[model samples]
Target: MLGSAGRLIRAVVDFALPALCALCGRRLAEDEVAVCMECLTRLAPACAPFCRLCARPGPRPCGWRGGLCSICADHGRQFERHRAYGLFEGDLARAIRLLKYSHRRSLAQPLGVLQARVVRADYILRQAEIVVPVPLHRTRRRDRGYNQSELLAQAVADLTGRSCTPRILRRRRATRTQTKLTQDERLANVRGAFWVGDPGEVSGRSVLLVDDVFTTGATLDACAAALLEAGARSVAAVTVAVAPAPPTGRGRT
Candidate 1:
């Protein structure tokens, strides 16, 4: 029973010194993470009456006739559809920043759960046969020590009971960061950057592409295009958050 004793000792230590909240640095109760319940509740809620194509807030309900946002209709995207847990702002944005740039992997669990919840509630993820995170290039993965999208996809797969094929998609090129780039530049940067590991694996399967943020949709579009090229029956996207596009006058369009 030495192993059991060791487990008990570890449990006791954990109980005595609970992990602190990652955001506020306050002592967390058992099972709490960097985000406390209070702060989590404060996050902006994303619900119905959203565009069917882009998941942006819409004035009309998501009726059967295929709800499409004006922007989405004007400029069709490669992915079939997109959804996110919340608008990127406040603590949500901060958490994403920490997870992506600061290497705080712990945030992935909560964010993934949140994304899965949104997907389930919206009925978007139920049809997905497999989940694939937007793969990072080998160089970037090595530098970061982990792929944040993979972590998020794993959590989503766990919650949804779907298989997470982390290696199904591969990044062939190490591209520059998408941040601070124009939409055209982002598109150019990601072109020819991705490939499929096994085309047959996803053949005739519905794939769910996962990522941390939906910016100009360039990254997700690239990933979705690759998956479709690999013979995926259909491809959709789910992200932790969606940044509001700036006004057309400000170069968003």
Candidate 2:
């Protein structure tokens, strides 16, 4: 129903603004966001059959007798509980990699919105007074230009009406990447990497720790320890992706 001029303008706009899915590299439909429906279907959720404490996918989907993984069973985590959207694989993993390594800043909001929806549905995030991301060192943040976890935590705060208090939790020193590190090495790598800048910021408040992935729980556990030491009432965590059980062979988050 358009005239020649209108049709020409429409065509040019479409050409100039091509829509592509961030995960699968497919052209997006008219109303699609960063990810396409096909890619979404390909992505798997961290449903039951996962560890009750850490949310790691397990062989016994419905048979978590004690609802604990070996890590959670042998030694308790510093956080009260952990929740993850899905495993770090396929489109989800690709998307996270793009956000973290490839400098895909636009993908953060879309991913954050998805994660915020997950948090809004959970009562744990609702009860938390503030959201604090697993902080990065000054050098790392400078090199990265931005912290992806900070973006995610802010989006969650926007959706759930919780305040993002990142200043309270900070990295005291830089450490080697968790990549290529053994379980014990991962724990020691992040052992004293984090600290609370001001105890009053989170004193007497329950906090939610945000991270991109849950590998060994070392990083989030370290952050939780600092929060608790500073007088936080309680601490829980939510990550976009949760890794598989022990003997993991993935890169750093």
Candidate 3:
């Protein structure tokens, strides 16, 4: 009786005050969730002609050499491979901002479904034994009352049926925002900021790291470094979006 009444009430409320698309603010269809179909179609996937290791799009002719971008070739990456669903721009970027800043936690589900598809479709990524999110510092997590990366990791793990070990990694310190920082500064800020809780949990296991975005990759690299140091067999990453590469910046592992 209560279930039926709840459903009826929800239906009436939805009819009277229809939910709008998170990105474009269009009225959502009965079957639609947070975002409408048109905005979903506009969310572009990160297409190829990108670096195989880091998934960064580059110039057509000479952007790669031996399947690696110049930065990957020279510096090497801690994570064996990384993938992004889309470039951080347009509606995709807007959606991410809404989730991260405006506390639109529900958006994590669809974003993570996109990430799970990436993992399922890639042979190498599908081999991961465990999933770990880039951890937020204790203070930050307290302030936000949630960790966006953990939400994403849980969703991916649920869809992929992989073990989500969010507690395996820890951020030992809080760093300032990376938004306006240079690549070097970003790297320095996150270096030594992450650690593994139990080496045994990751020993000889492949780890898939989840995060919201990839900028210079400093944070991901820091997390990967801690995982590798703790005896994880390998590390790879997936993010919802990848920021455009800086003009003079190089990749980090």
Candidate 4:
């Protein structure tokens, strides 16, 4: 068949080129996006009732009643609620790291597609008037040459029929990396680090913030607070993955 011949040729071309599945290194089909079909499905682990505020994954048989996690229960969060697609481990972890650190910019499309699925499932997010990725500082963006979160935001915006508004939120200054900071330290670090660049764009409108991971709630919360301060009606957030609930009594981040 002509179609079969075309697919074979394309697959051959993909093999000869840089266009392969970032996760498995398989030559991608013409219809396939960033990740292959198998890996795309693998990304959508069940997101049961998580913390209404911080978006932490609940334990097995998680008895959450749309309530707060222990960590979130005691603290106030800037965003009303948040959700994630899967736990940040295993294949999901590998894919994100490759996309982020290895300069696999092509992976953004598939990652955005995965994030889009989560948006469709959440009614509140589905109604978001605009989509914004957590912004990278100017210095960081210059170094990386692209913001992965913005790449994901653009894809989801295309799918959701909403505008991607990167200019609305700005990182006023770069802060320390949050890799090993405790919850309190994270809150302190990102505080006063973000603000709305333009008030007219977000006023009285619901905004959906996107990010790659939800380790500490600090970054997303900080971003949401800026939107709210700019007169945005409400702010909600989504992420590709969330860290597993720590084995003991506290957050891992």
What tens digits encode model 2's per-residue C-alpha lDDT throughout 1-253?
Answer: 3455654675576569777887777898976666787876677766777777777777865455587876787888999888888888877888999878766656666677667777777787667889998888987887776788988888778877889987779988899998778777878888877889989999999999988988878888889998999999999999889888555544454
TM-score of candidate 2 relative to the true fold: 0.85
User: Candidate 1 lDDT, tens digit per residue, 42-161?
Assistant: 777666676778776644555424577655666678788898998777888888888887656778888887988877876656789999999998877876667899999999999889
TM-score of candidate 3 on Cα atoms, chains taken together: 0.87
lDDT of 1: 0.79
Query: Lowest summed lDDT over 10 consecutive residues: which window, candidate 1?
Result: 244-253
Q: Could you tell me the TM-score of candidate 4? A: 0.87
TM-score of each: 0.84, 0.85, 0.87, 0.87
Candidate 4 C-alpha lDDT tens digits along 21-50? 877888778888768897778775646566
Q: Which prediction has the highest lDDT against the true structure? A: 3
* TM value for model 1: 0.84
lDDT score at residue 158, model 1, on the 0-100 scale: 94
- Model 3 stretches astray by more than 4 angstroms: 1-18, 29-31, 60-63, 248-253
> Which scores better on lDDT, 1 or 3?
3
- Tens-digit lDDT track for model 3 on 78-146? 998999899888888888888787666768888998899899988888999999999988877866667
Error of 1 at 25 (Å): 1.9
